[model samples]
Target chain A: MERLKSILLAEDNHMDVELTLEALGRHNLANEVEVVNDGAEALEYLYRRGKFSSRPAGNPAVVLLDIKMPKVNGLEVLKEIKGDPNLKMMPVVVLTSSREESDLIRSYNLGVNAYVVKPLEFEEFVTAVSRLGVFWAIINEPPPGSSRGIA
Target chain B: MRMDSIRSILLAEDNQMDVELTLEALGQHIFANDVVVVGDGAEALDYLRRNGKYADRQEGNPAVVLLDLKMPKVDGLKVLKEIKGDVSLRTIPVVVLTSSREEKDLVKSYQLGVNAYVVKPVDFHDFVEAVSKLDVFWAIVNEPPPARVNAG
Candidate 1:
């Protein structure tokens, strides 16, 4: 059996997290999601400090980041990740409900791999998340040195 | 009805079979998009720049570019550099779709600002499915960069 790379989901909203998990579960691909409630926790997880120090030894396949957060914003985290040489290869997808052009431009300029605007309709949202899960987790090839260790 | 904002997908692949498969997979997607197939990176650039045979082409930009790494002339990396280097074309999303899973290639593609990097699946079914998922995700899910003035 192929090992699935863990997904780091940085979303502060409880409802969004639940919906995202449900969507991924509908596709039977939500087994490896590590949910972080805010940007600070996300940083802790990614940097493998504090609680995440003993969790894993490598980076997640992809980080689904929400723009609005408590401690640090998605764009700030993105800048931090892309600014670092070791973490620059990590695939960061901005999954936010914001349709602001500024957010899109900032995310792209910061080297976000993909930016997805959350769908408004319930069924459409599910479909979007399902496709996103399948694409990023199953289809898209993670960068070299990823935790999945694909060759 | 299809959304009016949905743009075309520019595929720059040398292999005829791959092109056919990609087009078929794209057809399977819900979003209707015109697939512009080019044989090599040079031709892809020409299409983007509206040069040579593409001199009188349409003015709209493609929603995304599925670029193959190896081709007859001006390989994928070169093409990527050219596109990202150009101020007008830099915003276009370029996904590197290739068979090579070499670390150097992956690193280089990311370094050159590729939006996504997908390895061509060896299995025929998986290949088609990968292309299809890519089509749906890029064309339907992802928001493309706003149009810019093309001074060509």
Candidate 2:
């Protein structure tokens, strides 16, 4: 059987992170999520560097990226990912609070797989994340050579 | 409201049966009238580019393009490459909906910047469910590039 791929979530807000985890957990999706606080850590996780150097060898099924962060912002991380040959194909979804046209245009221009604006209401947010999780994690097939989780 | 103001879905598939099934599945959430079905990749491109028979069509691009890998004439990959390569059309989301589970196709599609890839399920019910989920995510949840981005 094919191993389930893990999901790398790069988000800065603690409250949103907790809410997202809770939403994924409600759908039994929490086990696969690996969280990072900022863009630099996200790069580390993806490249398996720094504290994440010994963690895993393969890429996550999908990256749920938040636009605003303390260190490297999500757009910078997206630019780096899409620019690299090895990491370019890994699916990255922009799960952000910004509905600004410029951000939407830029993300797509940078080759983001999808861009979803975070819902304002708690219930709507949960539903959106749950649907997003189910679609990316279970329904959509990740590209070839994506992480199949640790054996 | 202008016709182009209503963002429709463009489906490029050669298989008539699959087209019917997809339309049926999408009909649950999206209006059947909102889906513009093309029999092959050439027509798909024509519709998108507003060329040949589609010269007089609406100006705006579709919200999402559901592409099937195997098609007559240009083929899905070529269509994807054309769309992604062209600055005017690159922002429009393109999802590959095909029966092919070939690794090379998957790799190539992603390399060309496909938004998502879904393998069509053999089971009828599963196919409908998958299509419904896909529709909900792309059409409702996903924020597509603004129509103004394609003004060029």
Q: What is the C-alpha lDDT of each candidate?
A: 0.84, 0.88
- Provide backbone clash counts, one per model: 0, 0
Q: How well is each residue in A1-151 modelled by candidate 1, as lDDT tens digits?
A: 4343468899999988999999989867677788998888888888888977777567788899999999899999999988988788788889998888778877777778888899888888889988888878777777766754221
lDDT of 2 by residue, A1-151 (tens): 4333388999999999998999888768888889999999999988889998777578898999999998999999999999999999999999999978778888988989999999999999998998888888877888876753221
Tell me how candidate 1 scores on lDDT. 0.84
What is the Å distance of residue B113 in model 2 from its true position?
Answer: 0.8
lDDT of 1 by residue, B38-126 (tens): 99999999999999999998876788899999999899999999998887788788999999989899889988888888999999998
Among incorrect, acceptable, medium and high, the docking class of model 1 is acceptable
Residue-level lDDT of model 2, residues B19-113, one tens digit each, is 99999889897444389999999999999999999999878788899999999998999999999999889989999999999999999999899
User: What's the CA error at residue A137 for candidate 1, in Å?
Assistant: 0.8
